[model samples]
Target: MTKISTTQTQDMHSALTQAIRSEPSLIGGHEKSLKGDAGDGSTVVVSAEEIQLMGIAQPWDWKPDPVGQITMEKFQFCDLEPAKDSGKYFSPGGQSFSSGYRDFLALLSPDFQPQSILSAVKTTNQPPTSGASKSGWLNVLNNAGQLEQKPSYSTSESPEGWIAQVSTQNTEHKLTLEFESGDVSVATSSKEVSVPPDQVYKIQITATAWQRIQIFPGTWYNQAIITIAKARESQYLAGGMAQVAFGPGGLINSRVSEFVVAMMPSAVVTMDEQFASSQQIQASDIQQVKVGGFHFSKGSPESAAKLQPQSVFQSASAGSGKTTISASETHATHPYILAVIIQKFG
Candidate 1:
């Protein structure tokens, strides 16, 4: 093992002291550009409401609803298996796992799972294997352009005493940490304090989750955006769609009504992003796909007059996802499977 001289250790500590000073509050709102980190030139926007959780710190007494807190060790499954019979949560014409449904279950498959050199997940200030770079680098954007699920570790560490936080529009948990001290010192070394407040809480993502899940069942599970929809047609009868709540258009939401599906739930359902107020993973229920006025038809997208163009995917629909279909495609499967695209009503 290579040994670090006392001088090098002190230098590392001194650097951490200079790097981790408190950042100015982005109270009302803030917008960060990822033109550099994510190369694709996307942007993260924060409205005043969102900034309360993102830039600004929440009050000590803030307690969210539903008595939320779940542990992955005890957390049950998402019912990945197809509903064996025509019953609750199962649409009439849905297909079975054999008909293209195995693709999703493959997330947990060891033989096919992708291997990423992820840091050993820890809830405490256990130093990462290396400390040459900055420590508090949380909310990291994956180069693969997909929200990959990190291995969740169970812990009961409280969220109190957190001095700094890094929240994002992508991942479920907002990383929070109470530094060992305000300044790094030579005596203790930098390893302890350099790791920013981090926790491996339960994760949840938005529309992107349906795009491409990178969990390695055994292989490096990666599917480019172009071929994500390849298995759409074979999943019919397995893609749930019976008795889903409806709307005016063939789909209550026309912006999202097309593309292939063979087997799935009653509709192209959308799961809510996970928010763990506590250190434990909380239970979640099936969510409805929320839709909105922001239309990206034939390539036109919702715009900010003077803002930088931050949209990444060049599409309105037609990608991965078993039950989901684009507006045109949703109609083709209509009356067959209800395209209950939930509306994210403002």
Candidate 2:
């Protein structure tokens, strides 16, 4: 038996790239869904239970974790052996052993033991945040109501708010602020600014241009929502098939199906508006297209199959072939499916 090594597997994948490029039919349109990249970051995991509650398939379904499988070589290519019952080949003893078709079938049969992954893993969902920053200029007002200098916030803090004198030069500016994943918000010196001391707030600053900014103590983790976005084809090697144990000592499996896709608008740093606004995609038009997810296989069709479209509202007739669930009287799955379906269909 020929055992497959990691390097050997990579070599096999390399060979597959060449082979697939040389012969497109082998992969059968598997490369179409890949779009952006997740890069070297932490895994974005979603429990199966979460999928059920949302009436959406697992994100992994769209972006499968194929990391380990794709990296393996033997899986890239299979072998066949000749059969003994068919009278196709003459033995050294001058006896015909088997028929050609029988020999072929015998060689093709395999006892498959799918390589098992022992840990929960996922692919990067959305691309790495670009232009997202933790520190930005927070401009407030001086006690005299004059604009002061913009002060940078501490990167270590979260759910933090600041009030400072706006730079005299930037007085007219409406406080252009930036934060990681668009998570943080700033309230200017305007009357609209309101904060409850009991509510969880990270760092806060009281504004006074000449008097120096006052840093107030507040709760940092009051209401925190951590989103983990995963790409379509990342690999997850766990100890069991559907049932697996997570770190340290507990049985965690796909049975825990209700997880939440927290739509924290504040956390949305930015959409790839550049990609969305290039005139390549029309705002009014919907498309069924495929974009790359994490740990994906090399082929497009296969990659696309892993993802389920969301954020689009097509007629139920349009949803026929797609794996969609509908409520008796209404299609309650909103906005997410529309975009998903458009991307997939287009």
How many Å off is the CA of 338 in candidate 1?
Answer: 17
* Local lDDT at 299 for model 1: 22
Please write out the lDDT profile of model 2 over residues 1-346, one tens digit for every residue.
Answer: 0111111112212321232233332223322322322565544343211111112222311121132211111111111111222121111122111111122122211221221110101011111244332222222244576433222212111111111222223433121112111111112222121222222112211111111111121111100111111122222222231122222111221111011111100101122323223323322232232211111111232344433333231211112221111101011111111001000110
lDDT (tens digit, per residue) of candidate 1 on 139-166: 2223565322322212121122111211
Model 1 CA deviation exceeding 4 Å by range:
1-74, 84-88, 91-346
**Which 10 residues in a row give candidate 2 its minimum summed lDDT?**
337-346
Q: State candidate 1's TM-score.
A: 0.14
Q: What is the lDDT of every predicted structure here?
A: 0.18, 0.19
Question: Best-fitting candidate, measured by TM-score?
Answer: 2
RMSD of each: 28.0, 29.4
Score candidate 2 by TM-score against the native.
0.15
- Candidate that scores best on lDDT: 2
